[model samples]
Every structure is written in C-alpha cells, then in structure tokens.
Target: MNDKKKKSDTNSSAENVEQHLQELEKADYERLYYSQEQTFSADELARSINEQRLTELMAKSDEFLKSLNSELEDFDD
Candidate 1:
C-alpha cells in the first residue's frame, strides 16, 4: 500500500511538472509568434532583436539546465 501510494504521488508530481512546462512553452511560443507578426521601426527593430536575444538566452538556459541534470543523473549510480 505504501509503495502504491508513493508511485501515485510520484506520477502526480510528474504530471504537474509536465503541465507547467507545457504552459510555459505555449506562452513562449505565443510571444514569439506575436513578435514575428508585429511591425517595427528601426528603434523598435533593435528592441525586437534584443527581445529575441533574451528569448534565445532563456531557451539556452533551459537546455543547459536539462543537460546538467542528465549528466548528474549519470553519476548517480
């Protein structure tokens, strides 16, 4: 019974994390889509470029974190 409960709890937590990540991904995609759609003057274009850089930086950050986590898992045995 305890093992079953533990498994259930783990699954529930995993589902929650997956949902949150999906929400964040959707929001990021929405922002990127709008950024691509909107018109920008020269100054606005510079601002847009900065915003895109920030977005790319965030994606890189997530990738780095995921890679680090996977590497740490490999050392866990």
Candidate 2:
C-alpha cells in the first residue's frame, strides 16, 4: 500500500510540473517584456548621467536577459 501511494504521488507531481510548463509556454512573454530604447534630449545633461556608464550597463543587462531565456529553456528539457 505504501509503494502504491508513493507511485501515485510521483505521477501526480510529474503531471503538475507538466501542466505548469504548458501554462508557461502559453504566455505571451515577449510582448509582456518588450523594452524600447530610451532617449534624452540635450547634449549637456548632469555629469552624473554621463558618468553612469550606461553603455556597459546595457551590455550587461542584455547578457542577463539572454541568460534568463536560456535558463527557461533548460527547464523545458
């Protein structure tokens, strides 16, 4: 009886995981996460803005976004 209960629990867990994955795949994630470029006017803004290193931050954020999607793909497998 205990063996049967364990098997039943395993199957239920697998089914729940599969259902969650299906729901995840159905989401419009791209539209939900779309990022448009931002622009600011004026050649001379705050010195702090110039020193913020936006270029390096953008590069790092892009890499982070790519890794996020790759992590989801890993879960799919």
Native-to-model Cα distance after best TM-score fit, residue 10 in candidate 2, in Å: 74
Clashing pairs in 1: none
Q: At residue 8, what lDDT does model 2 achieve?
A: 71
**Top candidate when judged by lDDT against the true structure:** 1
Candidate 2 segments whose C-alpha is farther than 4 A from its true place: 1-41, 46-48
| Residue lDDT tens for model 2, 1-77 | 99988877778777988988888876656445552344555654564475558888988999999999999999999
Worst 10 residues of 2 by lDDT: 30-39
TM-score of each: 0.41, 0.38
Question: Which of the numbered candidates is closest to the native, going by highest TM-score?
Answer: 1
Steric clashes per prediction: 0, 0
Q: Native-vs-model 2 lDDT?
A: 0.76
Q: lDDT per model, in order? A: 0.89, 0.76
* Stretches of model 1 off by over 4 angstroms after superposition: 1-11, 43-77
